[model samples]
Target: MREITGKQITDAIKKLVIEANYKLDDALIKKFKESIEKEKSETGKRILEQIIENAEIAKDGVYPLCQDTGASVIFAYVGEEIVFKENGNGESILVSAINKGVSESYVEGYLRKSIVRDPFDRVNTKNNTPAMIVTEIVTGDKMKLVYMTKGGGCENMSLLKVLAPAAGLEGVKQFVVDTVENAHANPCPPVFVGVGVGGDFEKCAYLAKKALMRGINEKNPNPFYAEMEEDLLERINKTGVGPQGFGGTITAIAVHVEAFPCHIASLPVAVNIDCHSHRHKEIIL
Candidate 1:
């Protein structure tokens, strides 16, 4: 069995959190360029252009792409064949190491500390500790970490609905489009939408967030869902929310849909939105 040390995990997380905040994903950059060409509104085109420029400046790592450095979100795929060494502390070594890395990255990298100690008390966490980590066990000996700096603005606009199973596919489409329409500039226009269909309430929300992890250009492997993604993208852009909701031809860069089996009696749907920044990255260790 392969043995992975806590230090190794800490170092990896630190690098990933820093890198994701500084450099926008290549796929998203390409999409922005394409959208700039397609945008009919002069103001919308200018907004997209400025967004691209901001990304370029942040690539130097001296500054972040947005003021809201965002909460640290991690999806960890741990290989069953790999053994993680304990740190001798009572706490879980893996979780401790991950949080340590996150704290160091935010503090040392000069990223803003946006996390709070409690939802209501609103005291700042200072170092952005206790990252939102979701771990899954997989077959190989290597560990994979998918990281995203999820800003609050877009996250706040996400929604979930437990539609009647009778609501069906059309119902799902309507909910997603209406959610975007209701959000408008609040979620940051030209958003990237992630839709989760089926599953229970919580699982549906998770699925929607995972859908955002897919590459901007990547289509769902299942052709049925892939077609649905395309249809939703078209309908969303047609909302005329435009870039930053200024009114334009492209309101959304892409719509990604993920689905799972659910009880016959329930149809749970969720929508997770990400603003233009769309900061995310993946690494294997």
Candidate 2:
């Protein structure tokens, strides 16, 4: 079995956090540039241009692309054939490494600390420790980690609902469009919509978040869902929310849907909205 050390994990996570903060993914940048040509509004064109410039500036690493550096959420896939070498630290090796990385990146990288210790008290976790880590055991020998910098503005606009199975496909469409339209301009328009159409309550939400990790240029593998994604994209853009909600031809850059099996009586749907800057990076070890 391959031995993976805590030190390696810690260093990798730290670099990822800092690097992800400063750099916008190239695929997303391509979409932003393309959207500029399709945008009809003069104001929208200007907005897209400024966005492109901001991305270029951010690539220089002077500051993060967004003021909200966002919550450090780690999606970990552990391999069955590898052994995680433990340190003397009592914490789970992976958890400890992730926390250390977050703390170091937020402090040393000068990223913003937005996490609070309590919902009511509203005290900041100045060090940005205790990052949210989600792990799963996968059938492979290589471990993988995906670090997502999820900003609050778009996160707040996300929605989850338990619909009756009878609600059907049309209902899913309406709910998703309504959720985006209701947000108006808050989530920072030209959003990427991730829709989870099945699974149970909590799983449905997870599916939605995972869906956003997909590249915007990709499509759902299932032909039905691929078509659904296309229709949803067309409808959401029709909302006229446009770039930064200034009314344009492109309200959303993409719509990705990930679905799983669910209980017979329940149809759970979740929508995770990501602003124009949908950021994430993956590392295979």
Candidate 3:
């Protein structure tokens, strides 16, 4: 078995947090450029141009693309063949590494300290400690880490519904479309919609959030779902929410869906939205 040190994980997470916040992924940038060319509304096209410029400036200046630095989320896939060594702290090495990374990155990268230690007191944690970490055990020999910075505006607007199995696909489609329309300008326009279907309530919610981590314009491999995505994009744009909800076309850049097996009696669906500045990064070690 290969043994990995906690320090390595800590350092890697810190660097990823800083880098991801400052730079838009190339795939997302390409999509924005394409949108600018095809956008029907003059206002929409101008907003797309501003977004592209914001990304470029953020990368060149090493500044955050959006004012909201977001809550740090870490997804770790630990291989059964690898072992993590703790330095006699009695804490899980993995947890320690994550905390270290989060603290260091938040301070050095000038990220906002958004976490509160006590919900009642509402006191800031100062270091953005205690990252929301999700860990999975896998078959491989290496660990894979993903960092997703989720902004509060879009995250707060996410929703889930448990539909009777009788609701069927039409019900699912309407629920998603309705949720976006209800959200209006709240989640920020020009959003990326992630829809998760099937799984139980909680699982579906998680799946919806995970879907947002996909590349901006990547199509779902399932042909039916891909068509659903395309159709949803068309319908959402027709809402005329426009960029920043100023009223125009191009309200959403993409609609992604991830579904899983579920009980026959229930159809749990979730809608997770990401604003134009969807930020995430991944690394394998």
**C-alpha lDDT (0 to 100) for residue 196 of candidate 2:** 94
lDDT by residue for model 3 over 2-55, one digit each (tens)? 898999999999988987889989888888888887787888889899999999
* 1-285: candidate 1 lDDT, tens digit per residue: 899998998999998898889999877888899999999999999999999999999999898988898999999999999999878888887899999999999999989999989999999989997799999899989999899999999999999999999999999999999999889998777899999999999999999999999888899999999999999999998889999999998889999999999998999999999999898888898
The local distance difference test score of model 1 is 0.92
Choose the strongest candidate by lDDT. Answer: 1
Q: Tens digit of lDDT per residue, candidate 2, span 1-285? A: 789988788888888898788888888888888999998999999998888899899999996889988988899999998888868768788899888888988999999999999989989999776898889899878889889888999999999999999999999999999999998899988899999999999899998988898877889999999999999999998888898988988889999999999999999999999988777888898
The residue-level lDDT of candidate 1 at 247 comes to 92
Cα RMSD for candidates in order: 0.8, 1.0, 1.4
Q: Sort every candidate by TM-score, greatest first.
A: 1, 2, 3
lDDT of 2: 0.89
Predicted model with the maximum TM-score: 1
